[model samples]
Target: MRRRKRRFLFSTVCTLFILLAGLAGAALFFRIQGKIGASRKTPDALFLEYVECLSKADYTDMYRMLDEQSHLNISEEDFITRHKNIYEGIEASGITAQIGQVAEKDGEAVVSYNMSLGSIAGEINFSNQVKFRKEKKKGYQMVWDDSVIFPELGRSDKVRVSTDKAKRGSVFDRNGLLLAGKGTASSVGLVPGKMSEDSAGDLETLGNLLGISADAIGKKLSAKWVKEDSFVPLKTIKKVDELNLNSMEPREDNVKNKEFQDELLAVPGVLITDTEVRYYPLGESGAHLVGYVQNVTAEDLEKHSGEDYLSDSVIGRSGMEALFEKELKGTNGRTITITDSYGTVKKTLAAKPRVDGKDITLTIDSTLQDEIYQTFKEDKSCTVAMNPYTGEVLALVSTPSYDDNDFILGMSEEKWASLNDDERKPMFNRFRQRFAPGSSFKPITGAIGLSTGAIDPNEDFGGEGLSWRKDESWGNYYVTTLHDYSPVILENAFIYSDNIYFAKAALKIGYDDFMSGLDKLGFNQEIPFDISVTKSQYSNTERIETEVQLADSGYGQGQMLVNPIHLASLYTMFANQGNVMKPYLQYKEEPKSEVWLPGACSSEIADRIQTALGKVISSEHGTGHAAYRNDIEFAGKTGTAEIKASKDDRTGTELGWFAVFTTDPNLETPILLVSMTEDVKDRGGSGYVVRKDKAILNSYISGGR
Candidate 1:
């Protein structure tokens, strides 16, 4: 037993010795492997890591990788700033890299790679090389240089940039007359840095010529810490002749005289630079249609970042200008050159020729627009005329208009405030403003009644006298009372605008069919146009508690509101033979037309309605008799809507409206006209609207002839 125990102890001791030996051998092997792994890292791998940092836009990581020599050349802050400038210039948030093979040259390592930078101009792809040197402690470090960002750059070469501004496009009328264009104008101002003499006297002379206060000019030019070269713009004058220097006597007040003008131009601080201004030759004729431009905001810069828009760039603010901004604002060109330290051009590296903006031609006739503008000078109203067949708007005029040139010429705050405070609301676009359409809406009701087979064209209601009242649970059903007209047929009802007869006709059509017919006519639906428009609304039948309420709506007296443009578009059905043409402002546009109520009416029904409309203008007893022309035949309807008075005790004002269309063979297409005058003082009903409508149409027809 003692011999066996001694043998087991010897075996266990040998096993323990072997286990200790194996662990020591493994530790030594791993140590040698780690050293070998460190020695295997080449400059190629270090360069790739740096490129990866660039791909990720990790500037801080890239800064850390720079050698002592590179750090000495550029502080970390300066490095960050330089990198940021490059990123913004190229608009580069991320980079795409194609790594090339790294090779040894003259005991140093060189890496070739391709980089693609994205900018507003386009993607700029280039090839570049990075050089590295071996360091005893650091293993390897890059030799930093400006060429790291752009391969062609050098120590002595500096980058110079120039912008070639593209000329803004011009706006032309149908006759090729210039409406808005770029023209040379005077920019009068003070250059603080250029002024070495006493500016008080010069400023006073300048203020006199510019019609600004001398004290105001002094305050602007003498502001604290103003740079010597800073230009303080006083005004942009388009018609220099209107400055009236010749009319001013030298001794009369402080206004400058013609003789002193030359002296004023010679002043040290005074400046009269010739600059481009957006000129409106037609003035306020079509101001609402052809908007104006304004300076860019910070938000505009952010939104158009890649487009290379400067902070001071001008942009369209409204109307057609805003609608076609992208097309009107042509691509601006850039020229980048390499310059010496002394600012001398060393080489012209790149040049991009600027492409000017394209011109725009409108469908409007400048002659007709100007004539109508002058005709409506005395009235506060709205007028819209369109070709019923083509749906091209010939003239869209709103009274109480403003001269858009005032805005471009830098209108004063006081002037802007006065405009806003005007009681007439001149800036208000009445073309799109909603109003109770009155008798103008009767044609739609008539169309609906005849098309739906709700009322017979020849059937007579036996002339229901003046007022209409039906026995009802709700109070008096007298929606409205009209003057007595014999034989209340569809023809007489429409010709005389007999509300009593039509109200009964709408009730006979039943609530569902009446509303359904309106639906077919596009009531309560969106009228798509280039400019914004308020949707015409109909009374919600779901809440229409009584028949009287519905009856009032049937005769165009209750909750019915429509835009002038929309009303004109709807009238196209009569002249277009049941096809409602889509209205457009731009010329030569083939807008799609839709069939109105295919299931409701045939062409015969539309023709019959056209005849009744003709009688409204040609017939002796017609309400639209004033619009009747001796030389041409036309169809029309008149309306007088009651508008609520501003004061509680005063009676409601009358709104006169007239819708007319002429099928004169002399014209290329049928012209439909819709005119409305609110708060009319004349109680001649539609007579006032017809007289004005006739004058405009007469002028248009006479001019065309």
Candidate 2:
């Protein structure tokens, strides 16, 4: 009984001691937790103090609060300079600071605050997160992990503002095939604050994967490094396609710092960003028509202050883009979000959606344009074809054109120089360039004579082979004869392209009547068309001292200027039965609507002109007989314009021209083709030899043959 009592008492005493010790330990633990909680709490007065310090330019205190990496990266002088540069007016006005809630987790604490600068107030809501750890003898110290700045005040009273992401628009061909659209391109960027001793090795490995030199990557890094923050992107690699990006593998060797490594693993600076670039699968073809976009300049910014609502990086330089910029350029969308100093996205503030541009259907036939371009590959020339009735441009071809893709992607200075240095002046639109009309003007003279009744169609005119006479006033001017002095009819004059015949006819017609014909055909007037227009000039001088000068004028030469488009439209009178249609390019949805009407001419005169032109092409002596083809019955004319060889000599270059109209008996549609060539000496009659090759015309006639 005594042994049992002793054992029980000892057990009870041991149990009591254990219970009391546990209770004391619990109280001590609770006390330590309370002290930690109190230390983590941020005082509202601290925010006001910070604002006062900043206003007084207290650099030491500001530097003390910054993270160690930020302190090491930026000097005191630089910190002040950056602050002054970015926020110049912040100091002069009284500021206010408002403290927000404080949050703590693990050994870290976060304090948020709002700051307003003067009357021009804005919000600065920063997330001041710090890590605390014990140091050797010093009890404990705090280290900042990250900081954030944000706009606290709204821009407008509209509280329902929702932010939107700007999705790039798409580009398509006439067939709706993708040309230029949004896609991901591989790039390289850096976070300077995160870079450490191991960063070089990491960068070297990344460079190898990217197929770039380490030095190149380093140079880029050095240029774009952010001193105060690690989240700002530093560099961007251009033109990296998807396949290459997909092959890239992230490894520890490619990202040194643990935090940066995690970031690289998730969202690598050598990341693929969704971007838009101009593309052309047809390569250099249709380059001139499509044109290109380039970086906007200061001058451009000023000129488009209010009008520009899209990208600041691009603008239409030429071609259709320049001609119809307003219709083609769409409004851009924007997104405003509250972000922490580390660029971590907070809540989205506001957004506006982009408006898409309207699609434009061009009148150009791609196949025909390509054919015409190929024809002039070995030669230098321009060709233009149009529907006379509607003035719908079918083809406009200029050889030696540069690819528009190069311009869009950013052309180098050397490439630009090479293109501009070509002697052929490929950049110049020959279709719009001026050239002497030569003998092509003869038909206009004929129209004038007929219109004024100055010369009857059956009147007999004498012709000479080469009429040249010395005149003191005009120098040794010379006139060539039409078909030898025979009683040739009006049709015969055009068939033989009789120079003397027209000269005599012009004399009877009088200058007033000739000028009237010029005005009637849109000469000396601005005509609206898709392709650029170069005004045609007619010489007003009546009499020539030398017979040769008169002969030249009679055959359509000596100071007469006409473009292919102008000359082509002149033949519309014949095709439309004497009603010359005013040429236009804008197509109307409803054909009967007079919104874009092309005025018509008298039908009686058109019939006469048609009859004369038909005889000129089909007749034995016709100059344009070579242009005849079996595919379609056509009326046409050929002209060889004589230009002076030099400033001092009578001999000059010859310009060959051909204007033809395919007449569909059904009258459903009439196609007109005008081709012009300059200085084809070996090829006679203005080098119409190449023009008559019929490749372009055959394609047009046979539907892409």
Best by TM-score: 1
For residues 221-254, what per-residue lDDT tens digits would candidate 1 score against the true structure?
6788568788887777554543453555433422
For 1-705, candidate 2 gives per-residue lDDT tens digits of: 999999999999999999999999999999988887644434343444545766776746755555455557667676666555334432224545666665556543445665544311223223332333333332233342223222342222111222232333444443354434343322345555555567777677766544457788677666644453544333332343334334566434223333443444443344433345655433345666656667678888788975633335466677665665676666555444444455555655434466665455566666666777777755566677767655566666666676666665456667788889998776777777667766666767777777677768887754455563334554745455534635666777777777767777766765555666666677776665665788876653532433444445556775567777777777666666555555554444443211121223356656665666666666666777766665567776677776775436655667777777776645444578777777765577643543454566665565422
- Per-residue lDDT for 397 in model 1? 79
Residue clash pairs of candidate 1: 193-228
TM-score of every model versus the real structure: 0.85, 0.62
Which model scores highest in lDDT?
A: 1
Scored by lDDT, model 2 comes in at 0.58
Give candidate 1's whole-model lDDT. 0.74
Q: Model 2 clash tally? A: 14
TM-score of 1: 0.85
lDDT for 269 (candidate 2)? 42
